[model samples]
Target chain A: MKDKSIKMLKTIGLGFTEPLIRLFSGEEPAKNGKLFFKQALLPLLSIFLFIAIWYAGATALYNSEAEVRIEKARAEQGEEAALAMRKCIESGDVSCQPNTLPSPAQVYTAFKALWQDHLSISEKKADFKARVADTNSEREAQGLAPITYTGRPSFLDQIGTSLKTVAAGFLLAVFIAVPIGIVIGLSASLRTSFNWLIQIFKPVSPVVWLLLVFMIVKTVITDPSIDKSFIISSISVGLCAMWATLINTSMGVSTVDKDYINVAKVLKLSIGQNIFKIVLPASLPLIFTGLRITVSVAWMVLIAIELLAQSPGLGSFVWEEFQNGANDSNAKIIVAMFVIGIIGFLLDRIMLSVQNMMSFNKGIA
Target chain B: MAILELNNVSKSFGAGSSRIDVLTDINLSVREGEFLAIVGFSGSGKTTLINLINGLIFPDAGEVLLKGEPIAGPGPDRGVIFQNYSLLPWLSVYSNVKLAVDQVFPKMSSSEKEAHVLSYIEMVNLTPAKDKKPSELSGGMRQRVSVARALAMNPEILLMDEPLSALDALTRGSLQEEIIKIWSRDRKTAILITNDVDEGILMADRIIPMTPGPKATLGPEFKVPFERPRDVTNINKDAQYKRLRNDILEYLIEVGATRRQVSDQKYILPDLKPTMPGRVIFGRKKKKDKVKYF
Candidate 1:
């Protein structure tokens, strides 16, 4: 059973815990302890070292900026004005606080602040929903639209919005790429003819895709009720990230074993059966590889697309925090940066797990 | 009456300057319930010949006739067991067999189809591995799955293209016997293409040698007069088996030697010797009587 669990852990790419698990099970404690230190404790120590470096850097920058502010005050006015400026800065006044790099403590405070803000917004939303329930029912009876909160989304809501947008874009990419990939893959002529088009479009920037999508979506979706930004953001994300899956799928399909095709021919299977039973299964490993890359690409480009489109997502939240330039704005931006990175990492892990599950060749995945 | 026939069939690849003939004038016929073995050197177009009869590729010149009817393309009537096992790696042994059974016997009820697939798997002694994928199976086990899949199709003629060549000797020996046992139960017109002369003689009713290629063709056929259930141990001791094995080996060797001599005369290689440097550098002393033959 222990061996099985170790195998399962290795399969999921979390083999680092093996030594710790072995150590806990009392199997060669001396050796396992050394391995556990190398694998686990060392990484934990490195993380602390990184945080220390960041904290020191932030403090140095803040002090330098504060010193420059005091010097400017003394140069412009008298010593009393410089003293007042120093006092204000020292008291952490919003007006005179340095807007440079924020320290770890400030980031932690900002995280707590964001959580509190989310809780307050949640309560207000619930209260609004309850208050509008009767009016919404009446409006439904009269065939009219109900009232909405029309309030600013909290940080967590932005993350939720980002997740939803990425999910939609990824689905769009799969829907557009896989069938086209298969069709192009089956015919060498089609693959050759379309090669130029894929090469040309694959490297186009996300911002350009967003503009292109916006131009089409603005004219096509002129309805006032529909959220054009969301549509434009998702479509741009899909277009920007779909190249990997398309190329991989086509290559995968074209490279299916000749023996499998021969077997299909001898079995006299129809075209549909030939593809589904033999071709698809043979190409699944490559297709999943493409999908894993597509998902990571989708997540990487989603922020830039969302920011440009002004969608209520993490990208827009980061932009808004940067533009706000309040006392804790830099800290909040740092928080958003970490959030985005952690989310991207989690998305990749999820894709890898799904790829492993779907693939037939366990070693390749 | 012949169950499968090749009439003046010819096949080639490429065109213009690179054109090369692979098989030429391949005329043969397999009578109903006869096991015919075609043995040849590797790359002598044995696979091309089998593919012609299976209708995988059309003959450039003549026609391949099955039951006096010309074949259109590959069909379930000629079940081909590929040289590479060709069991779908993603599918279990059961599914691999069921796929062929489903396509050939679409009208068979679900339960009937299940039983049919299982029976073929059982015939190949692979019932325990029915649920395992080809990737999980050993090379021999994978070939068994391939055999079961082909057999489940219930083809009128079984076309095996070096099916057991990838297996080890012991596995090949056992599978050869198993195939014979299965074939003898309800005799099927089968064609076995192989490079091993002994294998052909052991399994086939009539052994035919394919001469060495650029344009390989079949030689005279030798009839195997052994009775039902030929014992492998006793066959080695039999006088007839030795004569047949020797005759086939001698004919193959003679043809190979003549082909090599004819080709040898065509190419006159240039004879030039490389000249070595005069002295060996970085040495304590050069040998006084050293031969500089480069």
Candidate 2:
């Protein structure tokens, strides 16, 4: 049981706990504990210390900003205005905006508030959906087409939109890059031919690609009902992210162990079988590395594309909140930042698991 | 009739002034059920000759024939065991063998293919390691998997390119015996390429040495007169073993420097002072500037 736990920990990259598991499994505990302290405890302590410093810095900034606000109020309106300002700032009233860096407590509260906001907004959406259904049923009874709900999307809706766009974009990138990469990988001449294009376009920034894709999308897509920005942003993400996968896939394909290629040939495997069985499998680890990078690049570029396109996503949400510059806007932006980070981390973890499954080389993370 | 034949085969690499003649005028044939060994030093293009037979690379100037049909490309009929084992590291020993079995005997039932794979694995004494990947096995064990992969294909010919050369002496000895047992049982036409002279004499009916090269070619073939069920240890005491090995070694040494030297311009060579004649002693000089006043 302990051995299995050790393996699982190694697979998930919790190498610190492996020693602990070994210790529990009847190994010497002192040495294991020392190792655990080195690997796990030190890092944890460092993180806590970092947070402490952040908190201290926030407190100092808040005190200074609060003093500045009080001084401003006194200069503008006298002691009464200054007292009111102090009370509002000190009591943390909803009306006044604090000019200080957000404390850890404030960030935590902001996170909770955003989550609650999402839940309430989802409840409202459900209520609106039900009302639309009822009204649509009445309208149908009167021999008319059912009316659709035109409600504004909530913050949660925006998050979902971003995820969907990124997914579509990532998928598009994979579809475009993998096949082209395979063809290029299979043929030296083709690789040479595509090298010029890859080299030229790969270094081009996401913004330029986004504009190019946006222009094409605008002219080609005339459908009024569809959210064109989703397609635009997604295509832009794909355009920006595809270079990583393409470069990696081609490299992986080119460098697949020559011995495997010989074995395939000696087996007299057909071209398709040779490619699918030998080429793809042998190059899978590197290809997956590329894909993981591609997904990350896609996610990073998505915010910019969505913001520029005014697409319904977390990118637009953050942009909108920044423009609002209300008392809660800074906290909300911080909320979106953490959300984006967590999502990116989760995506990478997902890719790593898939990579682990496909790769034959083990015992190295 | 010859099961495998190479006629006036020549091959080279690179182009223009950088062109290197790797093999030249290689002519040989393997009769049905015959075992032939080509022995040579490294860079002698012995591998290039074997690859030509296996149809992995085409000869620039001549034809390769399998059963009187011209060889076009690599085929299932020619199974090659490379010097480095060439077993797919990603696959288990069983799957590595099964891949060949599946491709060569496509009409065989799944159970039959499984049995075939297992039998060859058994032949190589690797049945215990059947489920293990090549990386999990030791060097000798990995070579056994390569042998099994080639054997499972049941090709008309087995082409080994120094298959046992990578293993240690003890492992190489055991594997050599196993290879002979498999060869004798099936009696398929086989070609073994190696630098080991004793290995050639012990395992093959005929031994041929390749001249050292920029353009390497085969020396005269030497026939082995050893009886069946030859033991490697016992063969050392035999007069015939000594004669054949000495004769091949002598020929290889004689012609080792006969091939035309490759020009230094072909390579990006480091700057070094040209040695003055009679200034450098040739043998076992630890560093440069050794001179003998004989």
Candidate 3:
């Protein structure tokens, strides 16, 4: 009994005194203290609560407006018209119905069905290729266009194409912009001479660039005959993305500390070493910011180009769905809108993660 | 033999109406392994003289020779420590020193170069903050890294331009001691541009005073007879140190007074505000009134 009491007393002593010991030792306390509350938990909790409030408020507003629209349509169309619309919907002729807006449940169902269709087609294609390889006659007769997967490419395939285009354009922009920007940043005379041209081109709309690019590709790139559509679209998107990197790089170089330049001079650092070691690293954070903005702009322009040019991309998929106006057309359009939004968000997040990694020396603040 | 020589060096700015002479027919020679300090008032062309030595700018007349050969441009052999701590802000202390060592000793192995830089950094007692950037280090620590960088180059002459004037008195004294210690080890030819008379007396083998400009020139060179490894605390007790310090202070005071008198005389409004109003302000004013018949 005495040993048990001693153990209990020690446990209670630690529960109370451990926090004080940790605080004095500069270790974070186990329980939340003023420092912990200010530094870690409070800000995180506040952000969480803010997001929750925003989601709830937006959902409520959407639901109320949707209900009002349904009621008004039913009242105006009369019971007979509503019955005809119900029959048309049951028969899968949704375009014949008066109301075009589908409920959220219908949209979700359509999205799942499309996803399943895409997966099934991909599986079918893979199985067909395997079977053809096993059979000598089938492989010899089929050629490039196999019969097993005869349907049009799915929405996911189109999205993949769109993403590839954006990647190619963004990479090309980076390659072209960095060297020129560094040169312009380093030399005052070059900057003055080139600045006017950059200013004139930066604000020119992507549509204008697209038209110009279309003409150039048609007239100049004649040998072997490139895909004019893809070339024009990618070039337009890349041009739109170029401005941000160039402007940001120049600004970054121009803002490098004067004392560092003096140090470079006194050390007699070579031109290449001075640029790569001193100027480039110093201007990294700003240049990365510019790169992020350029990527987002490229993504936006790529979609528009695909739609206008009838290129195989996510934008083309959306346009095709809108034109179809089938039973699942409205639902498919809503799903595509959400997918676009999510993809854009993911792209931005990736850029942010890369920026954070590059600037690790400068703490998160 | 003189390690460095300046012969009737002069510099001027602008041309025609805007032309102004900064330095005029100045001659000086720095002996081998000697520490020389040039002291002057603000805007007295001391910086211009140092720039000539460093080859950052050229003298309009005459030449500057390093070991009987003229300086073409800034080279690794003449390392300069600027008044402002010029450590590259993006570089850590170790890299800043290593950059110099790597350039000068390019044939050395990587490990050897690293060891060489770290030794100099440790010499300045900055080993603890070797990986910290200039922005993270204190002002004094940044200056210490600059010193380490210059020293790691192993230059024949170390040109310091008031390197400690920006630091607090205590930091300045500590750095001054560190510099003396470093100099005592190798005894490289050094020329310091400073305004502090005591700083000159404490560190230099000779203190040369510079007069003020539109046409500045070296006034006189005072030899310091104090022994090496001199203690700052006991420096005042040395009779020779005291006498040299007093002489430099006296000369500086005379230059200061002369400059003030010249300034006052130059800005004096001529009696051209006609004592007899419409007396025709013609080609030139009469010298009789300006002469002041006292």
Tell me the spans in candidate 1 whose CA falls farther than 4 Å from its real position: A1-13, A27-35, A70-94, A363-365, B264-294
Off by over 4 Å in 3: A1-121, A125-130, A133-150, A219-228, A251-286, A325-338, A356-365, B12-26, B41-46, B89-92, B106-115, B126-136, B211-217, B238-254, B257-261, B264-294
- How many clashes in each structure? 0, 0, 0
**lDDT tens per residue, model 1, B12-96:** 9999978878999989989998999999999999999988989889999988899899999999988888898877778888998
TM-score rank order: 1, 2, 3
lDDT (10s digit) by residue, model 3, range B220-239 = 89998878878887888877
lDDT of each: 0.90, 0.86, 0.82
iRMS of each prediction: 2.3, 2.5, 4.0
Model 1 chain A — which ten-residue stretch has the worst lDDT?
A356-365
lDDT of 1 by residue, A191-279 (tens): 99999999999999999999999999999998998998888898899998899999999999999989889888888888898788888
Misplaced by over 4 Å in model 2 are A67-97, A123-157, A362-365, B257-294
Candidate 2 per-residue C-alpha lDDT over A1-365 given as tens digits, one digit per residue, 9 for 90 to 100: 77887777666656678876777776888998888787888899998998799899989998888899899999999999999999998897877656566777777888788888878877887788787897889899999988765567777778899999999999999999998888898899999987999999998988899899888988998989788888889999998999999998999998988888888888878988888889998988889999989999999999888888898999999999889987777778878888899899888878877777778867312
Compared with the true structure, what per-residue lDDT tens digits does model 3 show for residues A1-365? 53454344333332333334446666655553665555456678997896567556555664565455446557998777656655654565635533355556667898998899899889877887677664646655766443355568888888888888888788888988888899899999999999999999999998888888888887888865466677778878888898999999998898887767766766688999989888998788878888989889998888778888787888888888889877788779878878888888778877866665455246211
Q: Worst 10-residue stretch by lDDT in candidate 2 chain B?
A: B257-266
Chain A TM-scores for all candidates read 0.95, 0.88, 0.73
Give each prediction's DockQ, rounded to 2 decimals: 0.52, 0.46, 0.23
